[model samples]
Target: MNARNAIDMTAPVQAPRDAAPASTWHSQMPDDKAMLRAAAELTRDIAVARPGIYWPDMLASAFVGYAALAGAILVSHPVAAVLLGLLSALALYRALLFIHELTHIHKDALPGFRMGWNLLVGIPMLIPSFMYEGVHTQHHARTRYGTVEDPEYLPLALMKPWSLPVFALTAILLPVALLVRSAVLVPLGAVIPPLRTLVWERASALAINPQYRRRRPEGDFARMVFWQEVGCSVWAIAVLAASFAWGWCPLLIALCVVSLTAFLNQVRTLVAHLWENDGEAMTVTAQYLDSVNVPPPARFSGLWAPVGLRYHALHHLLPSLPYHSLSEAHRRISQHLGEASTYRKASYPGLAPLLMRLARSTMTAR
Candidate 1:
């Protein structure tokens, strides 16, 4: 079946019903066929991934990030170092998010882009493409989304208020955690069979769900994982060795930069979804509503939610649409569907309101 046919978009668009109870909010909504069809038809021309855009953006972001990181480490002035470190974190965060595109782009769409990204941003960051490749796809699956099976989801809005802060704060330690995973656990896993299994199943993927356990990799994917693990291990050990041999200043600065990047990502992830569903599978329209879109006028969203992630709700509707094309795709669909359409319901004004909405939900959550 074609992409349009894949979604059950036969039902006509209707006024959104009165708010259901928090637990059943997403489960009861039906698909919006008019919005779905408009999205598919209006975006056909721009759907193809463009290598020209992809290569330059990735390369420039990587180059600027590494350069800023070097300046942060080498410059003696504390003020200059702080500015440079911030720049490095933002640039690298954008560069690293290309992994999201890698998962959706066809293998042939941009040959060698995956390897290029893994070398430039992935291994050095200790978050190789393999970590996200097979894992993130599960989040987009029809039946598994928002379920216990989904690696990328958790019902945060329904949890205690403290859970939200803890969820975001934990990401600040990711760089150190990654260092230990690669430098300590991975090397030990090479010799210990059980440790290898445990690490692979529990620590391999970039997942938010604590209960999700990854299966063993096989075929080409297994080979890819082996090589990526090797690269990360070697890089992690080298960084540690260099830190000890020289002063710890350089490594500490780099870790701080990565920590900021991770923290920003965690906050973005927090706002990406409404997190209202209580372990129930949602229809396409329901999923879109539960997700979010910080479109135009959300000035800072592009910095935090780079690489088309600002259109995350729309992304659920068209997972395979190239990142570079998301803005145009969003525009075409919004214009075609108009203000009263289901498509408009997903778009938010900015980040502050979304965060406030999530915080309010947590206060009343059962």
Candidate 2:
């Protein structure tokens, strides 16, 4: 169905007071049926892999992250330690963000990128690439995008004021939660069939919505899950054992780095969507409109929402486009579609403004 006829655009939204007054562009923009077709024709060539950019960006970010992590652990000065920890978190967060690309980028094109990521960052972080690959695709599925079946979605704007803080606070516990899930739950889940079922449905994926459950994976996907989980289980135990044998300093550094990254990721999640769908099945255009995109001129968006996530709405419109191409695609779209396009509605000023808007919305909802 075309966007104009199928999508709901009346959901309440408020721009941060400092933002340009909330635009009425959605009323003027072309429907998704046209937007999608245009995006496909315009980005077809750019969507192809440009490994020169991909390899260097991913590897360099991983290196900086690890080196900074080492500095955080070894440096004795408190100021140096904090700076190093923050650097580690940002770099590692960028590197780990590649997991999203893994879900969309074809394996044949990327070759060993997936295995390298899982070994270097994924298992060590207690979030195997398979965890995201298995579940994130469902978020892109048309029938499931904003429904209870979509693990990545939650209707935060419609919820009570108290629910918002609870959502943010969950990230504080992520490091411990991931460790327990991998080190303790994974092994038990293997031995106990019922527990295994529960783990498959819940703990196996990195998800936001509490009601979303994963279906059991099979064949190659199942194998990928098994090996990745096994790696995470081993890494978690080894880290724990090392802390006891060596010093708590190592454990502290790991916790601080992972927790900080996870916390930042949680905040990113908060602004990724307006969360106004309220369990309804939204049209592709409605979903894209409901999503947020923090465009250029927003300081540090390139760093904070790294891996092309700053263009989240555009990504929803064309899921197969690689991260490196999103900016170009957005540029092309904005230039061709003009200022009044619904695309403008998806764009936000920055993170602080978005969060303030969300907080205000939640209080009003309550």
Candidate closest to the true structure, highest TM-score: 1
Q: In model 1, what lDDT does residue 125 have? A: 97
Q: Which candidate has the highest lDDT of all?
A: 1
Tell me which residue pairs clash in candidate 2: none
Residues 1-366, candidate 2: write the lDDT tens digits: 001112222223333221422233223323667677777888988988777877888889989999999999999998998999999999999998999999998889887888988888898888888789868999999878777889898878768878777888789788998999998988998889999999878877889888877888899988888899899999989988988998888788878898899888888888888876666666777788778788887799887799999999899998989999999999898887776666666777788777777777677663
Query: What local lDDT score does residue 92 receive in model 1, on the 0 to 100 scale?
Result: 97
RMSD of each: 5.3, 5.7
Off by over 4 Å in 1: 1-19
Candidate 1: C-alpha lDDT:
0.88
Q: Model 2 residue 162 lDDT?
A: 83
Question: lDDT of each structure?
Answer: 0.88, 0.81
In model 2, the worst 10-residue window by lDDT is 1-10
